[model samples]
Target: MSAMTGELAMCGASVETLFEESVEPVVELVLGGQSARVALFGATVISWRTGARDRLWMSSLSARDGSAPIRGGVPIAFPQFADQGPLTLHGFARTARWRLADRKANLDGTLVEARFVLARSAIADTQGWVGDFELRYTVRLGVRRLELELQVANLGSAPFDFTACLHTYLLLDDVRNVTLHGLSGLEYFDKVAGRDRDEVNDAIRVEAASHSSGDVLGQRAEGFVDRIYRAGGERSPLTLQHAASGETYSIAQSGFPDTIVFNPWVAGKKGTKGPDFDDDGYNHMICVEPAITREGSGPIRVSPGSTWAGTQTIQVL
Candidate 1:
C-alpha cells in the first residue's frame, strides 16, 4: 500500500492496486524516461522500457492471476533449473508469491530500486523442498539500463546444493536479425542435440530457415535452440546487436558461471511452444540466462548460514 509520486522528474514507486484481488501487487518503478514493472507473484520483472521501447519480452498468454508461472520476462529459477533436480521444472520460485520488502527512488530522480523477499515457507507442499532458505531479489532501474540481483541464503543447520538462473527474455525487433557475441571459444551443452559441443564462432547469428539450407555451420537455424555455455565465472559482458535497427544491448553477469541461449522457433520436436507461449513468440524474443549451474558437474553447494549471490545487468547501447 506504500506509494510515492513526484512531478518534474516523475520518479517514485507505486503498487498497482487494480490487480490486488487477482494477483500479488505489482510494483512499478519510474525514473525520468525509464520505467520497469515487477510483479510480486514471482518477484518477476515483467517489463523494462528505456528509450521508449520495452527491452524485456513478456508472453501475451502468460498467466496474470498468479495461478501459474508467468511465461516470460525475467523468471527466477531457484533451488533447481529445469528438471535437474527432484523438484518441479524450474523449481517453485517462479510460481511462489514473494513479499515486497522495500522500494525507493534516488533523491535526484535518476534511479529507482525495489527489493523482494521469498522464504522457504512460501513454496508449495508438492515441491518437497525442505531446505530452510531465504531469497532476496533486487531490481534497479536507471537511465537506459536495468539491473537484477539475486541472493540465496541457507538458513538451515546443514549444507545444501542448488541451481539457480535469472531467465531473461530479451525483446527484439527480429530474432533473425540479431547476433550475439562473447560465447566464442567456449564449450557448451547443447540441450537440443543432447551433447556437449564447442562454440567456434565469435559472433553467433540466428537466421531464418529459408535464408539458406542450413549451410552455415555456426549460424543457428530459425528453429529451437537450447544450449548452456560454460562461462567459467567470467566477468566479461555479452553483446547482442539488432542489425535492422542498429540497437544493441550489453549483458553482464557476475557470480554466475553459465549462460543459456534459448529460442523455441516454430513448435517442433521439443513442443515447448505450448499454450502459455504464442505461436510466433519465439520470433521476437530470445532468452539469455545467467545461471549457476553445471550440466554434469552438479549443483552449487552452500554451507549452513552461507549465502550465494548472482547479478545480471542489461544496458542499452
Candidate 2:
C-alpha cells in the first residue's frame, strides 16, 4: 500500500478535510494501508484502520452532529477528567472545535503528522476554566503504529492546574477473552469500590480474580470495571492479548503515570452508562487509557510559561 499518487498526494500521504456525516470539518490522514480520521469538532479520532480492518471502536449511538462528545474512539479529556474537577464532565476539549494548525506527510509517508491547536478563549471561558493556555495535540500515523501527543503550554500569569487523559476506546473481538499484562503488583484506585488496592496477579480478568472481596476492594466484583491503576516506575508496554482473535496490541506511554483499564461490560450501572454504547457493544470495547487525575496521580501543575507533554503510542502485534 503505497502513498496515494497523482495530485492527491502530498509528501507521501493524502491529507485532506471533507464533510462526512456532519457539517463540521474532519481531517483524514492516510498513510499506505494505515488511515486515521479526526474531526475538528473535538479533535477526536473517530476511526483508525489498518489494512482495511477497523482497529478502533466507535459507538453507533454516539451523536454525530457535534452536539455532545462522541462516545467512542479517542476523546481528548483535558483540564479535567470525568466529573472529578469543577469543569464539566470530560472538559471542553472533547466538545470544543479545534483548529488544525499543521499537517505534514514526511519521509515518503513513513510518518504523517497533524497538529491541532486549542487556544484559551470562549472554550475555556464558557467552561469556567479561564486561563491563557495553548494545547497542541499532535497525531502521528506510521507503519503499524499510531502515536498521540498532547502538549499543554501555560501562557497565563498565574499557574493553573489541570488533569488530562487520552480517553481511548479500543475495539476488541471479545471482552471476556481479553487479558492485560504488565500491571502485576501495582496499586490502583478502584472507583467502583471507592477504595485503593493492589493488583495481586498478572492476569486481570473482567471480573474478580479472587474469591476474597477485600482483595479487590469489593465483594463479588461486578461485571464491569472502572479503576485507575498507578503505573509506578513501570515503563514497559502494557500488552493486551486477545485470545479469541490470537492478536496482541501493545500500549506504551510517557509523562502519564496512571493507566485506566475500563470495560463497561453491559453498560447500565451509574458512571458506566453509555447510552451510545449498548449492552452488547461493551463486549467489543475496552479503554486502556494513559491519564493523570486529581485523585490518583494528581493533576498536572503547569507553571506559568512552562510546557507539559505526554505521549501514548499504540502498536499492533
Candidate 2 per-residue C-alpha lDDT over 23-49 given as tens digits, one digit per residue, 9 for 90 to 100: 568898888899998989889998888
Task: Give the TM-score (vs. native) of candidate 2.
Answer: 0.90
Each candidate: what lDDT?
A: 0.79, 0.80
Choose the strongest candidate by TM-score: 2
Clashes of each: 0, 0
Runs in model 1 lying further than 4 Å from the true structure: 1-24, 208-222, 232-235, 268-271
* TM-score, every prediction: 0.89, 0.90
lDDT of 1 by residue, 72-95 (tens): 899999889887878878888888
RMSD of 2: 3.6
Model 2 lDDT at residue 67: 85
* lDDT, candidate 2, at 48: 88
